[model samples]
Target: MKKDRITTINKTAETIETDLLVYFAVEAKGKMPECDTAVHSQVKKAFELKDFSGKAAEQILFYPPARSKIAAARVLVLGTGPVNKEKDKGAALDMLREVGGEVAKVCASVKARDVVVCLPPPKHLSPALTDPEISAGALAEGIILGDYRFEKYKESTRKKTDYPGLDEIKFVCKDNLKIVHQGVEKAKNAAFAACTARDMANEPGNHWTSADFAAYAKQLAADTGLGYRCLEKKEMEQMGMGGILAVNQGSYVPARMVVLEYLPENRTETILLVGKGLTFDSGGISIKPSAGMEEMKYDMCGGAAVMCAMQAVALEKPDVGVVAIVPATDNMSGSRALHPGDIISHYNGVTSEVVNTDAEGRLILADALAWGIEHFKPACVLDAATLTGAVIIGLGHHYTGLVSNNNALAKAVEAAGSLAGEPVWRLPLNKNYEKQIESDVADIKNTGGKPAGTITAAAYLSKFVGKTPWAHLDIAGTAWEFTKKAYIPKGPSGTATRTFINLVRNWKPGKIK
Candidate 1:
């Protein structure tokens, strides 16, 4: 994974000599917002000719003539739409992130090695955008996220678009140098963690296995001063984690449970993050159709997001305790694959009848959630997984489906998601939904019928969480091919990485009751 070095300079965009100078502006009364007078006439002319409308995400590019006031050879303008005074800070940050993504995309297309981005002055911004530090961080995140490319396996000669990517990105701000630098640092750590998750999710199943996840977690712990431990098949079996053992019966590769912890000195509460690590889902005996089966390699995206988020947690050193548990395995339909009607007991002693092997994500997650909650005794628990296709039907790829037992915890997670540019929609968790997972032969079943499938899956996990303030995010839709945004690529959106980071970064002990 190659990342651009992001920096901030207390200087004007006109004075920066670079491959490109990018400016973001909002439309107002069909006139350009405050900009350098040197290029004011040129910009005004473009608006007059209707070459640029300055609509949201609209863009225009032109070269500066020799001896132009701006030092850059080329200039690009990106539109962020009309400002809304009623919009909150979250909306402002979201818009800036989109603008930042646009800047990176333009730079990459033109092979601009070094680029300078001019942050929109607060006076011309929405009322919510008054905070320069928050605005700068959001913009930086967009640049890092938009610049991601996963070409590790491509042959050097056969690779496409091999131009050296953005080598350096500089944010031009005239004042508040210290605050702006701090914002850039926050973006660098959180966004870099998100890219790390993208790289993991892009790897083919043959290259990345359950062991690879454990190995990565172990190394991340060593480098980041985190406490790490992993449970192999032997340990899981000893602990009677039947859900995991049952799922791994068909695969030669053993299952692993990777745990990483960040315990800050002034921690107020402990948050447990459980992620499903099904490396490749072949649907076991209830095998899925051959169509798009190759994409099952992304089944572990939830795990990638959780483990990689820990990297950001370590970097930021938030004043809260975080424990990440990923139960890793591959669900394959080998000769010994799990059979329908099989009853497996989880770590918490609750039994689940295996009705559909394709619904294996919940099985592994059940064990991890129960085990983590039992051992860690966290104040709150949040689990993310590509758990169900029903979530896609309900919310599509634009939002993550959230079901929670506690309102305060759910709202906290939703607020964090909103600020991170990952919107979460909460679905009603009714007692009626629990009836869908009830089993005649066991305590419960692995899946409910197709009706409200996403909710029932959450209902099943809810049994394991007991009274803990818990939230389950069905990220099946948003994990990949997420709504077409400039920063989010075609595959593996790295959906929950930043959401988890922000959840920890802004955590308040008194908020969760």
Candidate 2:
């Protein structure tokens, strides 16, 4: 993907020099928001002609000749429809993201290298972000997110854009200049981190192994000044992380448990983020069907999200203490590969029966969670994984499946998901489902059959979190290949990265604050 230039400026559309100048038009109750008089006269003329309607995602490109008195060669007008009418603040924000995405695609179609975006007039904005700074920030996030692309492998064959990346993205906002600038910076950083996660997920498994995860984490640690460590097979054996080791027995490469830590200057409360890092899950000894096994490369999406999020947290330098753990390895069918019915003890000393090797995500996460709690003693533990197909069955392609031990933590996660435009649904963790994972021989069984599969998997990981407030995000549906949206590509949605980052940035460290 091309790296773009994003700038927040206190300049007008006609004042900026660019290949294309874009303006936002807000329509409510069939009326358009106030526009710059210079552009307004033209837009009014178009509306009167019935040639252009100010509807959401609507656009029109105009070639204002040299005598047009416009600094830009072309001008584009985008419509954000009736956003002010939405009763729910959450829904309004989501619509704004989509609007931003549409604007980016419009620029792409026109081959606009240097672009300018004017913030919507205050009269048309939703009350949720009444502050101009907040509103401008949301729009900035949309523009950057909309510019995302993943064609690294095909770079040699792909046609180039007019510019390698966006020549300039200048935002013209009239109020709270400093806050708007800050918002743009934050959004750019977050979007860059999310795109990084997408790049990791989009790579083929052969290129992105446990070793690759370690190198990436170490490089991030070195660049950001975070503490990084990779515990190899011998160290894991000594530490007794049987769950991670058992699943890796079938692969040619050794297992690694990667740990990254960020210690902020302010007085601290520890927060642990654990991710399942199965690089390519071939389902091991049990094996998966021949069809669509190619998509297994995305098995490590949870780990990718955590790694990139840590990069962002390090750059943002949040006030709370944060730790990230990724237990990385591939699940394959080798002579030494683990078999169903095999028993393995976890880092927390809980022995589990491996009923199905494909259910390996929870196993690696179990070890990381147990180890993280022991070493970090974090106040809150949050882990995400593409764990079960049942989540897609339960929530379909729209939401992540959430299971939490604490009400406050659950509520916080849900709120964060809402703000990030990645929504989630809470699942019941009643003790009745716990019985599904109960084992006759071992302390617990890995597979709970098909019933409540997502919940039972969360229950299995719940055993290792101890008493710390914990939440599990099952992103089986949102991670990839569900459907294509205007902004997000069809593969590797980078599903929970933003929500996790939002939680860390807004968190109080104690009480899930």
Candidate 3:
């Protein structure tokens, strides 16, 4: 495991030795965040002189006076606009997350290797942000996430200098020491998982294939004591998972269904996770325009999220059982690539007619979803995939398109997403949308024409989940190039990875209620 970049300390801000001292300020008039009395007067003077206002994302960096008791060389104040509104806690918490990113960027700009952040007292903010544990988690998540850079393949001389060469970050929290440490650990685990997903997503198609996914999962299982297995192409063939094999027909690399399981002692219930792992999508024989096909390397972000989420679950040791399956393959335009009007059978024997080869994500996901449900008999099933471009058109990259067969499961997932700052908007899933996928030649068609494309894709996946409560996150829009936030980088947001971690950590048996 990589060394942790953040930790918590019981020391006060005024006594801690660090290159930078960080504080978050809110917009309330004459109200300031918890800080040293000397530093408070300085910030108060700045506010009086109109040098700073606590509007969201605002920051003021100044060196502490030589006479002041503050031990840090410099102090940075970040603005979080009016967090008192009780109506939107999710947005309020995200303000802290955004500020965390801002601090990381500042650390990089000034080359501050050691930093200490002073978390605001519970009395000065909204109920949601007032909880020290939740706020600490959000801040920790922001710092690591915003500081991430995928320069693995770049030469050292050409690498970006803006990368945060952070050595350590200590959180100054007024809450109980043990509680704050738990919060920091939670955030550390979640952020690391998200970054792992980002690393996989940023890998070039040729570098990250179905075999790479299997290898990564296999090693992760060995290191974390999780059960691991990968079904090779021949194994998939014998099992008659035609959907996955059909999608892999074009690639030189063989397909694999990578599975990781965490069955804790006295497990209450089981949840199955499925991700679409298209290592690359060239639209197969149908072919996509060359304009932006390079981004096709991100087509497997769903698989990255699921595989990395298991890393968090393993470390946290959540009591609930988790079973994750990723069907890995690349869709290329080889001579043997899948063609339009091709018919394939899924693991459950459901036949699908391929109307468009570009819609191959659903093809591979169908087999994994069916196989996971049949074998694990999980209480609920959730799947995430960058499955449709229509989702981009519908949600416009700000929201993940959620389609679920059960309302109870959908609400739970939505709440978890909100807390994770990877918000998901639930879309309708009924016979009205299901009818669009109905096919005359086969049980269902892969594409439901152009209208309601995202829904139709979910509708296609719905067939394989059977009656088990299921939710599908169409992260097509949110997986990468997500809404501009200081914490979310330009490529591969690692969106649903945190949401999955939060969901699994907070799982309660019979949570459908």
The model with the greatest lDDT is 1
* Model 3 / residue 165 / CA error / Å: 2.9
What residue runs in model 3 are displaced by over 4 Å at the alpha carbon?
1-5, 30-35, 65-68, 156-164
Q: Write candidate 2's Cα lDDT for 1-513 as tens digits.
A: 333468777876686678778887766455554456667877787777766667887776898887667888789887776657665666677677777778778778877777888777666768676666546656766767777777667756777543354556888777777888887777777777878888899989899999999999999999999999999999999999999999999999888999899977674787888888899999998899989899999999999888888977998888888889899999999999999999999988899999999999999999999888988888889998999999999999888999999999999999888877789999999789999999999999998999999999999999998788999999889989644556677788887888888888788746563
- Candidates in order: C-alpha RMSD to true structure: 1.7, 1.8, 1.9
- What TM-score does each of the candidates earn? 0.96, 0.96, 0.96
- lDDT of candidate 2? 0.83
Q: What is the C-alpha local distance difference test score of each model?
A: 0.88, 0.83, 0.87
For model 2, where is the 10-residue window of minimal lDDT? Answer: 159-168
Residue-level lDDT tens digits of model 1 in 107-151: 888889888888777776678877788889998998889988887
Give the count of colliding residue pairs in each prediction: 0, 1, 0
Better of 2 and 3 by lDDT: 3
User: Candidate 3, which ten residues in sequence have the lowest lDDT sum?
Assistant: 30-39
